[model samples]
Target: MNTVTRPRILVVGAGFAGVECVRRLERKLSPDEADVTLVTPFAYQLYLPLLPQVASGVLTPQSIAVSLRRSKKYRTRIIPGGAIGVDLKSKVCVIRTITDQIVNEPYDYIVLAPGSITRTFDIPGLTEHAFGMKTLAEAAYVRDHVISQLDLADASQDPAERASRLQFVVVGGGYAGTETAACLQRLTHAAVKRYPRLDPGLIKWHLIDIAPKLMPELGEKLGSSAQEILRRRGIEISLGVSIAKAGPEEVTFTDGRVIPTRTLIWTAGVVASPLIATLGAETVKGRLVVAPEMNLPGDDGVFALGDSAAVPDLAKGDDSAMCPPTAQHALRQGKHVADNVIATLRGQARKPYVHKDLGLVVDLGGTDAVSKPLGIELRGLPAQAVARGYHWSALRTNVAKTRVMTNWLLNAVAGDDFVRTGFQARKAARLKDFEYTDAYLTPEQVRAHVEGTARQE
Candidate 1:
């Protein structure tokens, strides 16, 4: 039987934005006002700031994800599917369910919060050869792969094979790349201690990027401090460089140097989801263009937010930029859009989106952190406390908050789980590997030849 009735408010993508929107609607509008339905491919909201901990084995995957049904304190119906295409003229959205079935959903009002996917560059052999740290499954795969590499290296007597397995290279100096490198480095250190045959010094981690410094978005001072701390932890930093060619067992640099390695992690950047393209709407940088009220230009009943929308930064004036894809902005935008949707029902004018930056924070695992809060620079424990506090408070469910805290308390008493058995089965997950290309792109038209096809198989 169909779950939703008409006059329904359809919200897409249950990340920070969609979740907040539904929560706010429950608080503001009575059940008699309108029926609210949330459609997403997943049933939980991912706490992104804690993802680094998941890859490090410090926090499990379940700790960061809040179940949608359990966490929803309202009467909103949750639909498990991702919107792939939209017929704006008819106000209908074509969705691809998680089980690969296509379903058509109609809505009176639409809120687009569908998040982004990994962005790809034209770098040679990158699409099929590199692994990304985007979702929970990706994070788990990385942890398993990294640990398995150590296990393989420790047992192998061949010097060449051991060297290839021991060297780990992470591309991109952004938070994902930087955190992945730091967390894995720590994981390796703890794992190798049990391997009496393996030398910890044999392990090498390289963090490469096209940019000059790491964490450039966090401003110059804090970004510099983050780079320094990482270097001190024995991580080799490579700036203004990127991989030229990548393969199953070797990767060559643009400067003509070649390094033999079985693992190449790609966390360069992200792009808007391919779902945006099928909307037949104007987009900037692959994001749906929205007015200050977060409403679509041609359609008054339609709205968009989060990584998928190119919302103008009103605080910066007419010549300013759009809001970034950070969790902070998504959460705020979700709440505001909920209010705007309600305002529409009452025939009230929508309010324009406006806000100032709340600074940035990056957790480097352990007790180490770097951040700029309210324009004041902080590092070490001071930054660590601030970073943890902010994330803990931002959690949508108290159960999630309690579980994460309990895990931390137990983790302090017990050391890391350093058995690296999963690394032996490195699956080689690439950017193009998880994309729903059949629906988004013509099979042979947009020839993004997924490189390293043989290695993955």
Candidate 2:
């Protein structure tokens, strides 16, 4: 009797790249071709760009969190956990489940799409005192924290304490930071009307970046336009500056300015997932280095994309130039890599990933916006429409689309209630609280774990 062997394809992460790749694989591959498995800490694929809106109460958390199980054609075995290590030689992935159980998942092929985590520095009290807006819970927590600050400021008798509570500092000039400052400032601006004792003038928002410009990717004209719009909204723009140190009550800047603030939102940048370290592979600026086809050079059946891989930008025609970690690229790359994976399994040649820039959008809340679609620069209301339309149309499912559309309409007409969910009432959260970057195993440990020689602590 002859037996047939099926290939096991394991995907890491539930991000845009991972979800897209898995969906495509399921659609393209037959049941007998391969068995697909996905390892993720969450069941939903988080639409990360709209996170600032969630933080500002413009959209509920569920609107952007598209459920992975919603697909009726689903065949992938969903693993409710995170891949802590990957032993390339043994072709095994070590996963830590939600219940803290360890499992060794053997795979014929592996696709690494574990997304990046918020990058931090060695500044004093940075991780201990600062809050991040990467995860859904973090965004919700931030909204509650911001409103709590307003409440505390209004109720406080100590003038100094009130001043500190009212003053907010957001660090980073990127999309997340800009949108966060713009949206939350609007939140506080409109929220002060509800608090009778609070003076709106007392609420101050400072947007700072060590870089000279706000959103340098938007080019000079659009960047200047964004900066002007933000400044006009009473947000203090401080370029060429960064936080030297953070404290419970205040933050010291590199320029020697001490700002009395209780809230510090850091969105500086992101480093690739720590899971990449387990492979003991070559990396570029902390990202796993992969070919234009997105496959590991020396390792067959191993692929990586999204924030975790430094994939070469084939459209640029330069080997040294790598694709920037963006949602647009990740979504496209996911589909492209899926085709490559299918072709590889079918014994066909894989093509290189090539894509041109499709422009950018920056929503500044309400009528204020800026976008560059197909190289055409747009600002104000037209840009807002373009930005929102692009986001709405890009949603994965009809349910997600409906939920987002409903949220947008409700927010516009009824506006926000500005209610806190008490996520922060139990305790304050740090960068380490949400992201488990330190939980990944080393290359040696990965081998030991896969071989069942290492003891589980």
Candidate 3:
């Protein structure tokens, strides 16, 4: 009797979707049934919603970056790399390892969940001067950069330079932008106390957005409530406006206002991962289009979810409607896709992904929050509780939950250190410095690489 080989499963990314998928697969599939492999640049699922807290120095980076290998029993073989391209025909994934090595990983089944990158426009000086809040490093760098500005402003005798260093401009009014602006404003507010020489009133925060309203998805009442809270905290909420051009020392708004500032934090939006383009598949708004079952239409053994795929929105009951790229959808889709993969392996039927909106939560630091959970509008401390509670429960591990809770407690009681980690001292960490948007293969290059790998095999 010959022993049958277990199916090899390859999962890309360690985000909410990919991590949840792998966890579900590990729980449901026995060692003899499947061999799981995960490819990611990092070995942790970055709890992204709490990234504002990280930037604000309320929580450490490690607390939100949940470790993938926390359990010794987890059987998935971890490959530390980012997938640059995938060939559906050849069933090979082209990966660029962290050590600058090229690897072609073949798989019996593939899950593409390679999340998203910071959405940027072609504004002249945007990428060159602005800072981003998308990744762990960017968050840390922002924290340090903000503090450094205070130090520089305090040391400088020139009034104009001091004013420029003290002013901070944050672009975008969505969840990330709003939270980032709010949290960092609080950080600066708190830090200025330590810098007695710096005028507290001079530390101005401007939150600008081209949209008519801030966090419009939060609805009228909740959105207005949030805007009010931010305004009360002294954040200059500039609606119906955006940056016309960004320079190192100043940003010119479309409304013809040039604000002098050394800091420009861009959190406008996110586009699907560039890896999606390499597949040469159908994409709606840069996201790969997948069936309701999270599988590629007419393409066997290929599945996509998270920010990369435009999964059908069955909950909306519309054929053309697709699920929004959110952590809420990503978490559920990850589990559903894993179940569908297991069903395919066992020769069983697959199920479609269907989930309703849970709600939105925005933590604005220091007991200020607005949330709409299960259709109930909450503000102030109650809303803060709801926001923190939702994020706490959503944490993947008990360790992460404990760390975050402890940090919250400490922040409530002890307050922040206001210490600069000196990340900016060694390098000029700008928007383009953090993300490698150029590090992807063209569709033609993907084909050529896949063909070459096939010949070698």
Model 2 spans > 4 angstroms off: 453-457
User: What TM-score goes with each of the models?
Assistant: 0.92, 0.98, 0.98
lDDT of 1 by residue, 1-457 (tens): 8866546799988889999998899889888789898888788999876777888788888999898778435588877877777666667677778898766677899998988888778888887778878887777777888887887898999999999998989998998889889888888878888888888788888999999888888888888888888889899899999999998888998878788888898988888978778776789999999998999986888999999999888887764589989999999999999999999988998999998889888888788889788888999999988888888889888899998988777777897896543533434566566555556532222222122222354
Residues 226-266, candidate 2, lDDT per residue (tens digit)? Answer: 99999999999999999999999999999999999999999
lDDT comparing candidate 3 with the true structure: 0.93
For model 1, what is the error of residue 378's alpha carbon versus the real structure, in angstroms, after optimal superposition? 0.4
Assess candidate 2 and give its lDDT.
0.93
In candidate 1 the C-alpha lDDT for residue 228 amounts to: 88
RMSD list, candidates in order: 6.1, 1.6, 1.2
Q: How well does candidate 2 score on lDDT at residue 15?
A: 95
